[model samples]
Target: MPATATRADRSPRAAEPSPRGGRMGALWRVLEGPRALDVAALLIGVCTAVLTVLGLVMVLSSSSVEAIGSTDGSYGLFRRQAMWAVGGLAALLVLRRLPLRVLKGLAWPAFGLAFLLLSLVAFTSLGHSVGGNTNWLRIGGFTMQPSEAAKLAMALWAAAVLERKGRLIRHVHHALVPVLPFGLVLVVLVLLGRDLGTAIILTGILATILFIAGTNRKVFIAFAALAATVATAMVLLAKNRLVRVQAWLFGCEGLETSGDPCFQPDHGIYALASGGWWGVGLGQSRQKWSYIPEAENDFIFTILGEELGLVGSLAVLAAFLGLAVGMYALAARTTSPFIRLTTWGIMAWLVGQAFVNIAMVTGLLPVIGVPLPFISYGGSALTLALAGVGVVLAFARHEREALRREGAPDAPTPDPSVRPQETR
Candidate 1:
């Protein structure tokens, strides 16, 4: 109420939301206010929900024959997958409201717990080998891959560390020193689990985070090349990995005459090849009838292609690309180095995971049991991914508020008075 202030002198309450805001402005206020991040979440959410439903249908198609013999009902695996989908969505909704700071506080503990689980699985005698990887722990009727949690924990921890020691991030000693122990820990845990795929994904996330934190580019590149070398070596040493790699690179050169260790990839390639342009039909995928292995998990995209065609598969890929683009865009929009780094890291993680999964299915890369996010048929992976999405959404919402508060000029509203000039 300054005396000199008149109605015209006052800033317009511009019908549009405010745009000028900083980090503190993204915090959730005590009073209810407009949510600015809903749009991003909605975009991601709609895609996930669609994929979830699609997953259930495909799981039913892919799992029924095996389930009929393994369980009393034909829908056993599909039923369980559906339940997990429902539960995962609920968990994501709950997480969407929490502020990023709150989650950051829990990051260290989460990382510790994830590491503990990885160790426990090795000793407990409960860890079962699936497709030659001893990474799954079964408790009662429930089973989960601890590595999924490990991935999220690692990302959060990286973000926290980089945020706290940002200035030293440019120095080799301080920057790489901090990440060295963590990298070692992750590598050892994953090596013990024999889950090289998960380890590779973690490496990608770590590298992205480091680069964003201003680590020396040459150092980052050296670390990356080293990781690639180790991964290739591990694959070459293991029969399972070798088979997949051979299948991917050579495409069944003299292998199919005997035992066919790379049979799954061959089948996967067949499935993709069968689907020319459109697809066979919805729920009518011939390859899912016990042809391709892990039809619902590692090779779900192939099934999507087989049933829905190249168009469907490409659509899914395009959506993933769009999501990554949007996430990175959001990160860049914010000035906070932490948000920027974390956002880019997460986006890289998604891209790396997606490419690896799809590549494994299409026989372009060696098979490692990574699932397509949101679309694959696994509860633990899906749930952990949803949580990550929640983090991004909260940041996005805060970002929108920040944009509004910063007094960013609103996009021009439609001119009701002016109709567009139509072509004569």
Candidate 2:
């Protein structure tokens, strides 16, 4: 150099001048720091807590009238949900503390059990039908939905299998062989139980796993087409499903009579329309007073919209969005295939199901009986969802430990003195 610059003149602090820009820069630095994953994990946990608590509140409000009429008291459904929540929290704690390998080892056994349960639900006298779907199993005094458990089992099993397949996942044969067959068996069993909604969700989870594993684009396209065709056929064959689809396509206007195919959908829209920007006020929803069917279960989002208004509904959406972002960030940052794939599968299951439920509530999609994740009043669904979150937390914990052991540094600083070279 003709003249060397002074240390003060070459200081990096001289780079920026605007206070707003400086603040933004600092924010970005913090976000990009080594504790980014920690922040993500915290975000995930917070969103889950917020959603679950909100769900409990909404469930209590929505189910009060029905509970008072049918069960012990106004707090009957709420008490049952609280008990399930305790059980689910226990599951979360246990799974979160388990080693990743232990989780992986449980994959096959879990899948086998799910398969066996699904088989029993579909083909045996032990199956219980609710809302015309024989997807539940009653043992003694307890009733549980095998389809819900199958979702978690499917995710875990797919993650374990796809990760083990390694680069061979790119090959069509390896990608479709065991994974597709097993997934189809589960889907078929679910369909046999007449639970099309759960079957669609299961298909989605399987497809998500394959996509995350880097399956060929053409194969994915073909698989999607096949799934669509099969779903269409199922809808066409089932008169009840066909009627629901017709009601959705045309309008549910003037079809509010109870027992009509459009009764639930019509009332759902009415509830949402009643809740303007501020809503009708919590626990004040008239729709939940024996108007909308399954107000505490599949159609709970409508009750939520009616009570909390648009702002509350949007807040719920935001929490789910945060959950998605945190889970996706964790998956992206992790180097292990199992961690990444499993996180993505769980993300798709929970987030995807939430959107499906919301869309159904908003009438953007036909009324499918999929429950909103962490929000719907279903013991089996809530328990399994929390258990899945626990699995994700375990992965996040493992990643943090790996980072700590490696002595990972903060975001790398760019060299101020490095000059750009001209290219010919």
Candidate 3:
């Protein structure tokens, strides 16, 4: 017929592989799209959904005992957790629809609000102390952790500030002036609560944003050293925290003794070890029966290991890893510098905090009382973390649309038999 039809004249779809090799291959074709942004957004959605479901199941299982003893029944805690999950999901949906211009416009007020709330927690009668950290504020019958909100606010604020500073970022003073003042202020307030874990996470976010903004190596180093010195000084000034550091270093040997400060770590290890490879079976963890402290909060990893074994533990790790990879890919592919900087800052914050939580649980690092992100049971932390994930998703969507406008390859097309409109 067209006996000499050239390759260039052939339809581009003719030579493409069919999505029929295997289940995994099909999934691969779908996820490995023409543009990385679409794939990343897809991955973030899938991971967030799976993690949220897993978190709810685990929270119900782990909190049943405490809920029954203190409240109406086992479902008491589960109900509250479910409500928080619903609220968080709603927040995510709403955040996804907001335009980037609106987000940028709100950055300053968000930062100021974050600061005011943090100040109230740190310095006013509104502060509520729990488990040795005065980081919560009780306002008008509602209890909220201001630091969690501050983390998201600061990320937005820093991106806007640094993106505007653009070329001026090469100068040390311009790089440090506004961000350092505002960032260090929020961090200092976090430290005022003696919540060192949250403080470290906030500082990590700040450092990551600075690095992404292209601050000079020498200036960054000096800033890092100053931060480290301040952190060390704060730790040394607090007796309980120094004791925790000491226990982390040399107290494992005395774990079997009653009243030892290492009891928590020792129990955490036992819980993990008890699960072997297949786990003790979901909801059957012995450690949840008053063995591991805060089993539904900071130390939830221990219960996760005990109930779901190494496989479940690794699944959580993998989900976080997927999120990190997806966010980083978006950061690299986006044309907008603010999007790039903000995505990287968020990727660092969530992924770094996740590993920090895991490390503390596995005894690879000192216990820092940091939650395991999407898998933890706390209300404020879960809600804010979900909101951050939503922001990243929004950015990914923007990039995908922008790429399409530039005539970049579209996402995978569907079969006309199944989705006729997608055939074009």
Candidate 4:
């Protein structure tokens, strides 16, 4: 043997693997088996369930006074939200049981359906306006917001298109051909309805999908700048939107302003400030009793802060972070392009919307009237967000099934005493 080889063999370090290699091997050992997907699914499911249950409680507490004043009793909004929650859960279970191929096949048609519903908002007398956004489709007692459905449809459609293009998706034109048209149409329809919040969300889903599909940075930046310009123009064109932006910038600072736009934002700040480190206790938020508008809908996070305190608010934030991490892990575990894109799109939409809602309530951003995903009290929003989680759960289970077919062994149980290490 050569001198170096003989010296290496004699060295005690030769018997042990390098730390980086050891960690990589251990990770592969853990993930190569079938249990990784199961753990991911459990984490996602638990986080979602906790958020759902917590949301129901918050809705009950925040909407009680309004419910009693508007209707007959305190249970009015709570009952409605409970019904929506039950429906959302059933939809989740049903979607989880369906095959991926079926969902892929339905993607285009679903997008079309979502588009048709959104368009109907302009022409149909059934279109209902609430809090200045004419995005609600109410036919008698049956009411729905098509923009909520549009968000999921947009994600599914983008994923399917990107998967179909495959390796041919090199040029910007190839990437933008169908997605831009579809996304632009949706954005225009939403803007026509004057729902800037949902419009921002739809744009975000498209932007994220395009970036993930390997569009060049120059192209994405150009598109982003164009989007910003258009959004700014829209804001300036509408007097109410301009007022909201102005109010958001100066109203929180106790600046002199004469408008109703600052009303809710100011109360939202008060709610958070009054809560301090520990809240005044659940069901005891004074702001919910007509002080804050949309207490259970858009401004629900304020109640969460006021009733549950800073600790409770942070707990909810942590739960969302956990869900996002778990979803991304599932995306990483998959090889299918469609699965990866779909997972990422849904993750961005839900988490992105949650942050936007929270920021608006906390006075970090202008209020655009988006709900807090699973934690807000909107039937369509809650149902679609849960359905997105179901899609993720299905992907996780699909991965598990794939591992089984590959004859992977059961993963070794992790020891609690072992400190986890990262590979370089």
TM-score per candidate, chains pooled? 0.83, 0.88, 0.87, 0.87
Q: Which stretches of candidate 1 lie over 4 Å from their true place?
A: 1-39, 254-258, 403-424
TM-score of 3: 0.87
Q: Mind giving the per-residue lDDT tens digits that candidate 2 earns over 240-354?
A: 8877887889865555434587778878989988999989999899999889866999899889999889999999999999899789768866777888888888898999999
**Cα lDDT, model 4, residue 122:** 68
Candidate 4 off by > 4 Å: 1-34, 252-258, 408-424
Q: Give the Cα lDDT of each candidate.
A: 0.73, 0.86, 0.82, 0.83
Give candidate 4's error at residue 74 in angstroms.
0.9
- Tell me, by lDDT, which candidate is best: 2
Q: Name the better of 1 and 3 by lDDT.
A: 3
Per-residue lDDT of model 1, residues 280-350, tens digit only: 98778888777876688888888889888899888888778657655754664566666677677777777
- Is candidate 2 or 4 superior in TM-score? 2
Q: Output the number of the TM-score-best candidate.
A: 2
For residue 328, give model 1's deviation from the true position in Å.
1.4
Q: Across residues 286-330, which tens digit of lDDT does each residue of candidate 3 receive?
A: 988877876888788889899899999889988988888778767
Candidate no. 1 TM-score = 0.83
Worst 10 residues of 1 by lDDT: 27-36
